[model samples]
Target: MIRPVAVIGAGPFGLSTAAHIKASGIPVRVFGDPMVSWRDHMPAGMLLKSTPAASSIDAPRRGHTLADYCAAAGISRLAGVEDIVPVGTFISYGEWFQRELVPGLERVRVVSVDHRSAGGFEVELESGESFTARAVVVATGLSGLSHLPPELAAAAADGPAPTGPVSHSCQHHDLSRFAGQELIVVGAGQSALETAALAAEAGARVRVVARRRVGFGAPPWRQPRLRPGSPFGRAWSLWALSHYPQPYRYLPARTRHYLVRRVLGPLGAWWLRDRFEGKVRVEEIDRVVGAEALDGAPVLTVRTRAGATGRLVADHVIAATGYRVDIAAMGFLSHGLRTRLAVSRGTPNLGPGYVSSVPGLYFTGLPAAASYGPVMRFVCGTEFASPRLTRHLVAAHG
Candidate 1:
């Protein structure tokens, strides 16, 4: 009997990979609610860092691009590089793609995945149902990977909740809750800057604190045209990283990790500058050394580049600190399975076609960024990842 391939997420990576596998005449089962992360975790007025051209969910067949969705849905299609994509619009497009290509997607949660002694895997769902699959692709995206700095984590007495004195930026879906309150947003990246802007526009007193000077991306017209363009930006380096990800794994482990962290380092969108610049107070400091709740309000102790220390108090603190990929955080993978899989800096050590050390196990999306380059960190990477992994599965398991 042939078992279906299990794709453990409904996000861009999982949906695109499952669509490709199904197109190749392979049976696939996709799990998780469609666009749940974008719809639930992201703030209400957030805009995607990716441009309209780079925001499509890849599909095996044609007629499913973001342009197609916008045309069909009567929304004006945005084609210019300066045209920004709203998170809400992207979420709707993803749901549309799921309905069109991967209609059989299961909206249930996968409680655990364990390897069978005889060779496949046992997948247990939250509904108490179990199934076996010949192969498993862990495309869970950034669900369990929200990272909070140690200083801020200690300040949240009851843990980082959306309504608490200290919380990670990923917790809130609406910034209006903080209206008429004081907010101190930590980090210089798009998430922090945008969250501060949104909160200020919502009538909150907003301030931004960063370890370094805040930077914004260059205007699209100012980008150098001598080099070929990639979804990230127009540069020879960005082109190579986005197009030739297969070679990225062969680089030295230190270099690979370094590039993954530094290539797309902290920066804000050019369009967001007007909304953020004068509206919020931005403070450049050495680091946030400590944080604590004082009088039920969050107080952050910071150091200056000149070796001076000071404190900033706010009604609440939002740690816009980004995500960190750690396979161990994936509680669905049994401890035994996690320990057996080889990893580099908490990410799976992937081989050709996104397969991990375990023959039948695979991972993609943010988890693959370390091995496949920074392109895997965005939705457009599905264009390169989906077909390659699908081909590998067909050849190896067929």
Candidate 2:
């Protein structure tokens, strides 16, 4: 019997996994616009938080890497500790990787994935084509998962129309459009701080209203170390988490959950420190009591850490809040399949080999972070996820 697999994302994990599957002698079809999120969602001129070495897609075979693309394209091989990566450079590298390694990747969107009655998965595409495969891997990156606070969501709904003053951080590709206007950015993470700085540089007067005092990450290590590299900062704990992903599952569930959340909590990148400080005003508001639209402007009522209440008015509100992965938000999964898949804290619960409760069904990337650990949340995660998943699949069916 010929067993084939369908990979439903063309991002780093999807492309990496598909490349590994093909290398393992298994037939696979990978679908989606390559690097769509990086190309369309992120603002131009944005820089990656990860270093050059960690910001690569893992190819099963040698010769394909971000460094290779940079060398071939005559761009600076951004491998130095002080070197910062631009979003466009990363996207171009991914496109190059797909072309060279994961050729035949379909640039079509996956409409739905349902279980075939006999066995395997029935996949539908936006072009109205369909096919059946023995397995399907959900590698869709942060799509349909941008989170907004409840108060902000309600205020956005109360407007005369959708897409009002309130917008999630992922929705904007160009921050320069808000020029000469007052903008309020919420949250203190990299996205929030970077967006605030970008908006300011774009000529928008921006203030970041975060619940907690802002924090910046330590500068990247200037020299190589004995331990392996990780996208997360250089810490013994992070090094352990990066290297021992499979073993991380054995720890208590609460411990796993806490590490995932706290290890990389709201902190700005080191490079962003100069641009964000003194450039953007950061208010450490204790809580957002209410958000309302008054005469088309946004008003945020908040209490300070000192327990004083005040209001901030801005022409628009940008919630730089990060994404939250909930399997139910993935509309492509059929009701029957989604209902059957087990979940932990809104993420798909995966067993060994990253397989969900439904046989041959898999979840990687952010959705798998809960089960796999913090490494799954970054592009470097493909280094671990791709080979492991491919090995399991090839052994089972090849």
Local accuracy of candidate 2 as per-residue lDDT tens digits, 298-397: 8989999999999999989998888888888999999999999988778887888888889899888988888889989899899989899888777665
How much does candidate 1 score in TM-score?
Answer: 0.99
Worst 10 residues of 1 by lDDT: 154-163
Candidate 2 residues lying further than 4 Å off, grouped into runs, are 1-3, 158-163, 221-229
Q: How many collisions per candidate?
A: 0, 0
lDDT of each: 0.92, 0.86
Model 2 C-alpha lDDT versus the unseen true structure: 0.86
Q: What is the lDDT of residue 20 in candidate 2?
A: 91
Write out the backbone clash pairs for model 2: none
Overlapping backbone residue pairs in candidate 1 total: 0
Worst 10 residues of 2 by lDDT: 154-163
Question: Which residue pairs collide in model 1, if any?
Answer: none
* Candidate whose lDDT is highest: 1
